[model samples]
Target: MIDYTKWDEYYDGGFADEEPINNFNEEYDERSELEKLEYGGQKTNVTAKQIMQETGTTAISEKFLYRNGVVIILLDYSKGIFDKWKNGRILHCLGDRTYTTQQNTNGLSIIDRTLFNADSIDKIIVRAFWKDETKKYRLVNGLLVLSKEKPYTIEENGKYRWVFPLSLMSKYNFQMPEKYSYFLDIKSVKEAALINADKEDGVRLTTLNKLARFSSSKNDIHYKRTPQKKIKYTSVQEKIERSSKIAENALILADFKCEINNDHFTFIRKNQNVPYTEAHHLVPLAYSDLFNYSLDVEENIISLCSTCHNQIHYGKDSESLIKKLYANRKELLKEAGIVLSEQELLEMYNNS
Candidate 1:
């Protein structure tokens, strides 16, 4: 019979370790030790199979951080499970925390606007972890969807996460499994204010409209509806907000005057120094698909007062207004390589 202790020592030193080290030129022990320290003493250093065998648990709690700020809620799920779910649709949210990563139910004031700007969309890499399991990562472009529910009245109360409603999930081609029914309903103060003043009258409309522009999302379109039985409407496309550069440039180009009738705004915005005017994409940004070039450029942007802008889209003679504007910009648009005729542009707007 072979001597077992001498055989074990020979196997460990010569065969078990030497073969892989010589073949791959890898320093597994050193790399693992470094990763162990980098991941904050987490158990990701162990293999997933080993972890599963030891703990008898398949699911893990994952936290996502962005620029060192917490942006994901603590959710329990396996990597394979989340990957399968994400195949349908991936959603993310900004967590209720200060920049210091401490929980703050009050608001997102402590959040860094530099990295997590509330006004614009940001692409973030989500780092997810499950108890002692190897950490999983995903890169997704996500936006903040404000909760419709009141924070104070809710049982948990105060700060909460953004939710993907079933309606929206279907729109995005994602379906939540029957077993998981959790949805977020938390909103920030700014979002709440905008929702509350959705249908403002007169002076309030100016502020509402201004706030609406600042708070609009480039990826999604939202609309308010009044109950009616006669009309059946289907949502076709998401609204894309004009770039800040395009809007501001248009305003400056028009010298703050209404492009249609050359009239100044009726009322000045409450805290703003400039007269209020809405930015209108001449070719309608919604139909941007038809053109090879971007519709969000300065030449395609026009400034109009609230009344004129609304009339162009909803009034009985909106077609005539669109034609007139097209006529005015045809040459300039031609110069910028946007060669759509007046009727072609009008049809594009109507279709959208």
Candidate 2:
């Protein structure tokens, strides 16, 4: 399991282990610790040329730290973008304490922006400047749930914005990957982020547009919807049954693997080898047309990793709920090993 607390907030190292080595003074060397994290046990540097070739994004020349390990992120950026950086620490004192990391580029230095792709790159170092906020962490099922939900209303620029304490911080001295999962909720084009606008929205819907650039996903989502109604069913029972067919059929096509509830994705850190992945739906039956008797189909469904799934439904998107779905329709069909058509979906079928 990845030590998210160490990366997300200040590190106290959980009740002072026996070894208790104080290496804060020592420089962060990523290569040295690979042995403890992975099976192969070797930390390697990612090249800029390789990143550009695979990601199809450009980067300006600049140097930054990743996971305390050496990472290459190329992005065109101006200077002094990370000015609002506030130093913070996560004190595990008695039980769970409170903390939040924010990411808003005064202006992202290209490489700083995270790009949409497959898999989570754990070896990245970022500096997290924090301010004292009222929210903290809640441990559920041995997982640390940030106090992002119960946000207190705040006035930034003469408007109300729910300021979340949690956001992306600079990855300067990335810790070695222990037996844990890592997630990069945010990233940049290359070494730097694309923008530095703090406070996603200031008191108006217009300002919300500014935040659109930050929606970088780790992988393209995948999900399918059930075929349309074919039968002339009219009774309430018929409607319920019809809806169920659509939702169920859609899920059947995706192999019932809730992408929004599973891993972000899989991809080779280096090489052409692809990774394993499944599909997830954005619109869950709990909130959507998924009914006690029928399928719930409204306009809100998406495919996502377990983490993004939790984030999308649990949080409010200001005016609407940000939904996700599969990015590739053909891939979804191929996975299901069957073909469907818009016409077949809409018309009820019976023995000819």
**Regions of model 2 farther than 4 Å from truth:** 1-232, 264-311, 317-352
Q: For model 1, what is the error of residue 248's alpha carbon versus the real structure, in angstroms, after optimal superposition?
A: 0.9
30-115 per-residue lDDT for model 1 (tens digits): 22322111111101223333333433433222233334323332233443232111111222333333232223233443232222
lDDT of 2 by residue, 185-271 (tens): 112122221121111111111221222121223243323344332344567445444443333333333433444443445433122
lDDT of model 1 at residue 128?
A: 28
Clashing pairs in 1: none
Per-candidate Cα lDDT values, in order, are 0.39, 0.26
Q: Residue 181 in model 1: shift from native, Å? A: 53
**How much RMSD separates candidate 1 from the native structure?**
25.6
Cα RMSDs, all models: 25.6, 25.4
Off by over 4 Å in 1: 1-242
* Leading candidate by lDDT: 1
What lDDT is obtained when candidate 1 is compared to the true structure?
A: 0.39
